[model samples]
Target: MVTVNLGMLHYVIDHVYGAFMHRTKISPPFFSRGWGGSKLELLERLINQLFPDVEGQIWPPNLIQPMWKTVWESKNACLREGVFRTPCDEQLLNALPPESHYARVAFLTPKFVSPQNMACVVHLAGTGDHTFERRLRLGGPLLKENIATMVLESPFYGQRRPVLQRGAKLLCVSDLLLLGRATIEEARSLLHWLDSEAGFGKMGVCGLSMGQYILLLLLHF
Candidate 1:
């Protein structure tokens, strides 16, 4: 014979129910579907091997000029897009085409350029998101204040998505890890480019979901 405390039993039942619903819910997609425990361990080892001892400036050592091509011009704002080529932290993939081995950025700036004291926000969209949600949100408001805006499409996203992948989100966890490695490096290069440019002395970053988390990580990096 056993006696169960009603309060404790209710709490345990609620937690169990919540956990079941959480794992069963399909609204928030997962990128690690094909990654098994062993594969996750492999990813961990690879990361440790590459970054066992790391020390360097986040900005690029050699700041280079990026060719900014105006894709769209309007009375309110202008859009400039360009690709910045840089090496990844590791050689995970070989035989990548020159065009595919680069990072891209789109700059949406006010029609009027202020030499100084102008604000600029770097907008990072969600992971696997083709839509520039953050840019769309900030474009109008920021431009109203005479601020500039830029969007960075994540690696393995947008046109950068691998042809082998069927969807926007990655199926292989290892591939996703590799993308993270390169994306962070490319983001650092972006900072270098911005630092050299005028009116970027004051900079801010905005992101959504995973992108928001990336912004937080960039602060520590």
Candidate 2:
């Protein structure tokens, strides 16, 4: 098991940190939420943005499942928000509404202030039983700040609950790991999509707990 300490370090320095320094490559002039008092009207502005809202609704074989009802998703041309991990089959992508642009925008939304021409910040949630509405509620302040219009997303624990039957059964470590991998896999999909479909800009991800882990994976990718 990955220790919490090193794992968090891997998340911050590699992923959350330096979102702007890298965005400098594209000479991006915009900024997301500023870290402190740094102010810029265009700090968190969305340009050529796309929001792809998908659903991760797992109807397990068992009629009675423990996992949450659904996992919400949000991806945009500029910023995507959700936990989209499992590999996408042709059917899945095709099912999604067609996109007008080939590449979408992305953002980090760090508490920093710059202009609007910089890269983007992407925010994903960690373990929680949050519904789409609830997630949006939590994201209200940031969104209203118009801090780089986040693509609010969902993770396994976010809205999709695990098999309460099995998870509650208190299974072995392997079983728990199996469950965890599926959740992480869902998170992986989001990063993969950003890397492949989003423009070739400096991308950064931020979250706590599971969010942190997913951010780490994004950096490694």
TM-score of each prediction: 0.72, 0.34
Give the per-residue lDDT digits (tens) of candidate 2, residues 127-182.
54243343344444563343442333432232333343221222232222333333
Give per-residue CA lDDT, model 1, range 105-203, as digits (tens). 888878767636577777776765775555666676878787788787776777776675545657566655566555555666666667776537777
Which portions of model 2 miss their true places by more than 4 Å? 1-85, 88-119, 132-159, 162-172, 183-185, 195-200, 217-221
Lowest summed-lDDT stretch of 10 residues in model 1? 90-99
- How many backbone clashes are present in model 2? 46
Best by TM-score: 1
Candidate with top lDDT is 1
Report the number of clashing residue pairs per model: 0, 46
